[model samples]
Target: MKEIAQSENIEQFSLKNYIYIDKTEYIYNLIKKYDRVFFSRPRRFGKSLTINTIGTLFEKGVEPYFKGTWIYDKWTQNTCPVLHLSFLKFSVSDLDNFKRDFCNEILKFAKTNNITDFTDDKEPKVLIGNIFSAMPEDMHIVLLIDEYDCQLTANINNKELYEKFRLFIREFYAVLKGEKHIRFMALTGVTRLKDVSIFSVGSDIKDLSYDHAYSQMIGFTREEIKKFYIDYLKLGISYEKHIKTDCVTDNDIEEFLDRMAEHYDSYCFDEIYENKVFSTYSVNCFLQSISQNQRVIFGDYWYEAGGIPSILKNYMESHEIEIDKFQTSEISINYDDFMNPTSLPYMNENVLMCQTGYLTLKSEIKPPRRIKLGSANREVKAALNSLLSQKFFNPDALDSFYDADSILEKGSVEEIIEHLNKVLATIPYDKYPVENESILRALLLMYLSGLRCDVRSEQHNFKGSSDLLVNFKTRRVIIELKFSKDGKDTDTLLKAAQEQIRRREYGIEKLGDRELLQIAAVFDGSPNMRKITEFKQIG
Candidate 1:
């Protein structure tokens, strides 16, 4: 019944009654295995908490805070001086301010540890070197750097500024390369920038980004969720008005988890693709919502909590990124290519998108080893579609597009078609020319994704693939699309589409307990003037 805490600080876990999913076992093993580690994951994946945990272990010695954690008894009670630096804490608006602020932070760390006789140099590299030189030979410090690539990611759009910051941070990190006083070092960031000295200079630092063992280090595994969140899940089920009973069944609990997984799970980080963890922050937010509202609402917690990452937003605005391609088609990249350091301005958009959490590792390919990436989950897919719709549709059109949700729930074929046509009319024809069936399907899928329902395209069954399938609370709509460039008879095209759906038996296996509504839609006119000519329920 206690509130779930959202603080990034590990010390606050107990103070704030936070349900801390114990990943200390994994973290303890990581510390024992690697002396230097560089971990790159998308934002809000708990990189800061991971950093704070490491800092807590080394600097504060696991005690009252980590009583129930795995590392509490395993770790020695000996504490060491820690230099914890988070780039997020610094002002990165300009070069001088960044340098001065970072230098002051280093000085503050040095002063905390009682290291003296350091120069007041504005250069971060000089300050770090001074601290290293000033430290006693017997005392080795633990270094945990959080958001190491923050400045670079923030200035990615500005090539000149980005390069300057990159060079400076590279030099600053390079100081730690061969420093004997550094007992252990860990750097966490959203990206692994190319030419950073920390990776290339001295002894190799292990990158655990793609390591299978550490994939679930920062996120909530299914087992963890089942063990930790069962009470909240049961409470949510109890509050459901439709259940109408005090006793909850196992199927009820599992069905709730299934919905949660659909919206929040399936973020794969390793090459093996065996371990998929739910978004940690999103899971917490969902549980918090259930606790506060006493009702279960599977909302877009991750995307809603942190809107499009700034780096991704800037990349999208500046680059010619085909937003539809990523969602509509299969995407794969070589393992080596994906792991390699990405440079700015000329960075691979797909790689960047994967790094920023827009896409996640879907599966692994052998022979010529590669990784397939796709939308992490339903929440991400819907968020991406909503973003795409905003880019292509005006305010009025967006309102009309969202209104389709209510129209869809009513199961009115005519109303749904009218709303779809209104949304379609607002598409910028100059940029997105609907020339063929595939384009029309993609556009329709984009709009349908915005609706508060489960929308999927090219859903394959035994017979064939359905163009689009939408699942409402009680109804399943199977849509078959047909398009003609020449002035073909709309009625004929509509009938053909209907026959294809019936002949193929699309979504027949999926009609478990819900009412099925099969519709055939035909689009007529040229690329610029394409509009839905007819839509009819294929009863």
Candidate 2:
């Protein structure tokens, strides 16, 4: 076996030696045409790495350092100053100080270029404008901004400050977007904020984020992985450990490669990537592992270094929804938009889902054009499901969600809820975990609603959702759950819920399936005053 263990040659392993695919070539092309360029990416996904690579190409003092780089051989154009700023280190405690933070980073970038004259300026944007103007006219100064979305992302719900800070950013970036003095500008971030103004006001900017041609630019393709791993495979590091067992052969590389691809692939550009993407971050992390002679990094690459499941969970819990609902629904308005009026911006859940990697675009036709996008491929879906299920949601409350047998099982399903109701009937529902327990119960009911039933949230039931419906089951149930912050009374809440359910004809659609649909009301913690009622769905 050809051994390329990490201890054997740790010093020689550099991305420069590894063939950089995708976005790299296109970025160089853009550099040739424009002076200032901006790009964005999520955290730990190689945003800094891309900038460092660009640094090797154009940093004023690092010119001779590009000796073996592909860019060194092909980039014969005149040199320009590269202004790179990574704002990951910047703290955004409040939006009010975002401009100050941004301006300070701009100062740091300027200082790196030895421009320290106006570091103390109060009007930092003006100073920034001046710095752009000060760039030598003969050479284009490349402006690379990483994590441009950090400030805004750090405070998603602070509408007033976010909008104010966004405007500050708009005015600052406008200097580069203007006709004179600026070369090409590239800005990058995790996702887009509709009111960020960068997308709307930037005149000539083109988003290559979703461009298929540049798709492989930022990541390792299935083909790249096979080639890169050929050496590792020969090293006795058993390809079977990662791709297959020793029984595999060269002829099996195709099937083995396909398996490797599925576990790690996900598309993110309007879901343009689908399962085609190889989680660049994950692949790199794997390569790091393989080079270190660690064959099994983790079960699947998607669960490890690729995407942060916790971040997704934070979004889900904050929104009070499940991961499955996100996979199935479209998000037109962010929860921030719901919390703050000015933050209202239409978000096509599909597009946002695609951009963020949960969904991928499936099809597009030119003549009779229509775009079809859907959840990531089966492999990614499985990985995501596994990752999300393990998240902390009252860890001690429920060890697991309903399984296959628990679901779609007639007597079993009813018994599961009935068991839950009996348990709930005895407990105090006005406490901390009470809402979660009740919500957990609701989630089980919602899961059952599936193809046969439909559900929505409203405020008629009490302080929480008015009615939740499940139409497919033999008897549809109109469920409502509410709790009081201070008092323990749930009698009124239960009555309101039952009345609302009846008035809205919650089980009207289930009439054909059964003569009666269960109608129950709980005052949550209304002493022993809780009420349970049943009614017929028929006329």
Candidate 3:
């Protein structure tokens, strides 16, 4: 940012560069109400920077860093021996080395602060409180910890490590929980993780994750979006029309805001409220994209890219339940079900993903709540789709990639459909029974979707949508598959299929002979797809 590069601190006005926007005001406001604060946000959502700014304001040093920010005017320059410790580095593999490693780090930190009270064989928690105790009588102590879940979350599968690390951390945090030499305290992480457990001393500090009051404290709000658009017009984004109508313009706006919304947005704390959350990662990426002319979004590098999906794929493939219809109820309606760090590991990924801005909570039944992967942000969706369909996937593969022209021009539709049918026929009815036709359609979509083309089930039509439709440029085909399960008679199934097709307007477009079309019938009258029925297009 020009503000960062230029020495003219007085001229620096807006925070269009880093994650230093709303969290500053948030910390300042919280400092007024609560002496001790524990805030949970997904990683990289400006927690560290916020804490850093707090140190600059209240700590002993105030040089170039505290120049033009709003805190300068309001800050009384309180002389406090401030201690900044990051929880992310507490990561250890095993229990024995873990304790020694953490203790050594704390010792080194104490030496840096001119504190000599710590000695071997002493509880680390007691030493942590001494950080404040050693401060001069003239100065108070401000403690800031970022990524508070690191010690407990990292290498969570190792029970021995977790128990030891948990106890150590519980003791370390207990010093603060007990309010020992603690003033203007703040702790940051992705989730309010301690509802089931505790760290030692204090009564529960306020958790604002689901609180409606400070919802906009961490990310850019819709109003803030308009302000940014207005200020940065050279980006060529128009928010005027949206302002008149009390809406944000989706068209012609640089995909930056949209991308920001997708990666971090759609985090609705309350089930009834429809507010979207902007992730700290995607917003920063957008700013960098604008600065360097590189378009990026949540999918490009927000968090773990191909890894999580592949992990989920492997688990679903190995399991008996059909992956397509897999729901949270299958996992006892627990969002943290994905938190397992083994086959499909959840600890690092879950906490880190949420903190780094990839996944968010969709809803909560009671304790943990339901976590979903993708954002409901339209801009973020567009940004990701552009990257995933074209950026991530290779363009050279024809039957391999989405450029369907190569497939329609060079290959036979009949052969393709027949090959797909052969594969479909192989799926044993006993292995994956048709719980419902919709579920069957979803399974078919999953299999067909893997083939590069934009394969969609329940394709939108005049009356409704088709069961499946694949549009490859000029070559378009609509196919309707039917399955009769259990006690349902063939006539009833056939009628339902016909009505669905008619309602969905499957053949309304009228494809020529150059295009191959099939109205395939998959009869699951018995346990196998032995009885077959076929329908072909005359055109």
Candidate 4:
């Protein structure tokens, strides 16, 4: 396959010459039902572009950009005046500056329409009133606000400051309900602050964040990928010359699709099973990386663009949440949590995760229902692992655990035990308090996670549940753990654990022409004086 170079300007903002995704149909349908709408999505999920598209669609003449798009023939003949305000173009730090920035946007739009009635000195609400009153009654204003919650969300650390900004925004947008000349209005933000004054306005605003009708509005669908970028993908996959197959078949293409889906797809905004969409930002990054270097690299494009929001990092640290808890997929959260305009006084982890796009809606019932949460994709999982490792675990300790994993794959019990002890020694005193048999198992699971192993905790069998089972490429490692509050006979506990694994025949079914490595870990003493007592293995 001949290599094709993708545009390096994928990250640049330009509505012209853009790969116009078919969202016009959705927008047309949306405007017909709701005059005021609030759409919330994660940052860089193409909210800005969508806003621009709406604005351009209402322009006087059908621009060349919409020549062949869905809206070309279906759009209204008379274009209306568009008043677009972007919160990102301001250097706002406080409520005053935020108001000033909004007023500036109003003044700029007024100048565009040849109306000189607005001033920067006026309050945001007064300026909004002046602009709306000055517009011709025949030319209804198309109001579009992008990054509407930027000021409040950016200052989430300052409770008083966030509240002030939220109040100002609410009061400013409160005019939307009574504005008579406005034809349509849409607001976009990273999160919805339901309790905030803005959304409490009497306007009947529809939230499209989790609505199934617009699930694919922000991201690329699988079929869209194959239709738009088949050539680019073919060239990109050919660069993976390391695949051991003699000749690539149709299965290889499917495998490539699976790989992309694992890293970037599976973002479900709605409870519906078929509503998932890939992150458009990550997809472009992936294609751009592969095209530029001719190699597949799933580097931290989204996470690195902007690391986990500082608000989330502080929350996690304050709560002292273990990193492994992210793997727990059955967390429950209320649907209203994401709609509130103000930050919750005491936010739930699942709610925070879902709103910030780390966890997405997995399944749900209708009204008064609890929604299930799970990781958005492997890209997010890898980002969390990187963040957790850097924040909690020492580099040397992680290295030792990884080295121990390699040794356990083929080495004897004594060799693996020595390496694992080194890893355990790196645990600080603070981590000691959380130490227990479960923590030990979690530690092993975390270490094994670095490798491409299929690890299961509390794996069930005929006898009982095994503590941990790690299936490597060629071998199976079955581990059981026991804990003691005092420095007692942990040796016997280790022996008993090994015997339990043997009795259950944990690895017998899949041990054909491969090795079954059984190991036992025993912890002794209380939290104040705790350490691993002994490590045993059954060959």
Candidate 3 per-residue lDDT over residues 240-339, each given as its tens digit: 2334322334453445455455444675543234555565455545554544543222243343322233222332333334334221112123444433
* Candidate 2 Cα misplacement greater than 4 A, ranges: 1-24, 33-44, 60-69, 112-119, 133-139, 233-248, 266-275, 287-346, 365-370, 377-379, 382-394, 399-539
lDDT of 1: 0.80
Question: In what order do the candidates fall by TM-score, top score first?
Answer: 1, 4, 3, 2
Query: Model 4, residue 8: what's the lDDT?
Result: 23
Per-residue error (Å), model 4, residue 188? 1.6
lDDT of each: 0.80, 0.48, 0.50, 0.69
True lDDT of residue 332, candidate 4: 64
lDDT of 1 by residue, 460-503 (tens): 99889999888877778888988878757878898899999989
- lDDT tens per residue, model 4, 251-335: 7667887889988888887646468888877887787777788788866577777777765675666555555566565566665
Query: Candidate 4 at 518: error in angstroms?
Result: 5.5
Residue-level lDDT of model 2, residues 88-143, one tens digit each, is 65666654365566677777777767764443554556877767666555545667
Top candidate on TM-score is 1
Decoy 3 TM-score against native: 0.67
